[model samples]
Target: MSLVARAKSLANRDALTRVGLALTAAWLLLVLLFWLLGPTGTTEPSGLGRLVRVMGLVLPLALIWVGVSLGRSIEILRAEAADLRQQLGRPLGQDSHGRDAARAPMPAPTARPAAPPHGQAPAPAAAAPSAVAARPRPGDQRQTAMRFEPGQAQAPIDVTTLIRALNFPDGPDDHEAIDALRQALRDPDLSRVLRSAQDVVTLLAGHDVYMDMLPPNPAPAAVWRRFAEGQRGSGVAALGGIHDREALETVAQMMRQDEIFRDTAHHFLRHFDGLLARLVPELDELQIAVLADSRSSRAFMLLGRVAGSFG
Candidate 1:
């Protein structure tokens, strides 16, 4: 079934499960009444025959209720499996199977990606192995991309591209998002930030900690400006407006116990911090708010809170 139908089916299944449980409860109540009143006064079946009748009536419903309980547990297990597969860089959905084709990650492009003319789709990027997907640590002594700065590059990617790249592509068919990300990847520094942000957010989803759950208490433009102007610590802490303590604690716990997660989180933080420091100066308040609403920005907010970037 299509995902939309599958989602609706799950919803309908939940309702059916609830109704079945309620019916099972009603049957139990009737059983209690049968025992209390005893079949002496009425035509109600009694003795073993009556017990047989009750069992016949209750068994199917009881079975359904038990199945529903187990189904919920199975769903949890399924979600965790999907999360693990995703973390291992395996495809979670059918669309993800083609993500490598759509992404076409390369170490360096043969030609610089110029912005497509307005309203035209971007040309297909040349196929290359995904270099950014599995990045090496800085300690590996391999140089990584760091070529972007505010007003420094000759052909800077537009804010829309930045926003789209931050959100990343939805799936293989999300051509617009894919194209924007492709454009962003042409810049060394921006690409690293995008990849790092992508890794941490994907990891966070495994913990069932999503960016949307946090009430995005967006800091004012002045607060964002302070952050862009090289302020650090409490002076610009409001930028980390995400206040979901449960999520913060989950990330904090991960940071403590999971060495790999901690390292990735710190790497992502550094890349995002550097990129934001450069990018924000060029945007207005409205644009800043728009950027903040993107998926990557939400991840940054959550991680910053855990890392104490926001006081």
Candidate 2:
């Protein structure tokens, strides 16, 4: 409000430079006004009074500018916080107090059950259970809705489509891969493997371990057949044939250090193992070799080798 206070507020380097230039121009205009309105030879107000008057107007305008800038900054911060909350699924059924709206209590029934018939034992009232278990998430093998049994899935996903879907779509425009993935998702057994493979592949991608980049050492049909027949350790060591040292080291480190990646890799390994069991029984040696060349198969080899699934 006071002239000194207003000037002190605007006295920062950037603001002072702008105000100094504005004051210089204001001084000239005030002088010109005084000359036009002056009584000849009579006294006029001092320069300090004119300076205070001009500064009173400019200071309010400067405060408005600073206020607008701060307001914009606050709005941007609030918007970013909102986006972060949305990303974290913060509004997933909880209210402001953190109580789940979805789990709100229902009103009790007003009437009790009718009395049983005379001379007969009274029937017990049946209590309705409303707490249904949460459905298993995608890639969770605990679900039996899609899975029939290990090596016994009834859904007929072909070996080729199953392999292509496991690799996932090459790009959004790769309609063939997308179609194959869709078909695999429809199949009971292949869907489980594809979903699990997707998790492992994505995690591996974070470490720059791409299935396509890791060329596995060729394994013969007999090795795959032995693995399919439930052999483990040294008996199936040939299946762990990916020899890229860098990729192997990265995966081995993750298997030891990263819990999520380790679990996902194991899950993918199990599903792929089951898939091999189911399909190897139905395919010829040529089809088995082609299956080995698939990206899904490569990921299995990389993971199996690192996790010592094949010793």
Best model per lDDT: 1
Q: Going through the candidates in order, what is the number of backbone clashes in each?
A: 0, 0
Question: Weakest 10 consecutive residues, lDDT, candidate 1?
Answer: 128-137
Q: Write the per-residue lDDT of candidate 2 for residues 61-143, one digit (tens) a residue.
A: 56655765565555445544443343223222223233322222222323323211211112332321211111112221111
Tell how far residue 23 is off in model 2, in angstroms.
44
The C-alpha lDDT values of all candidates are: 0.62, 0.58
Taking all chains together, each candidate's TM-score versus the true structure is 0.53, 0.50
Compared with the true structure, the alpha-carbon lDDT of candidate 2 equals: 0.58
Candidate 2 TM-score, C-alpha based:
0.50
Cα deviation at 57, candidate 2, in Å, is 53
Give the poorly placed runs of model 1, Cα more than 4 Å off. Answer: 1-86, 91-154, 171-173
Residue-wise lDDT of candidate 1 within 42-64, one digit each (tens)?
Answer: 56555988788768777877686
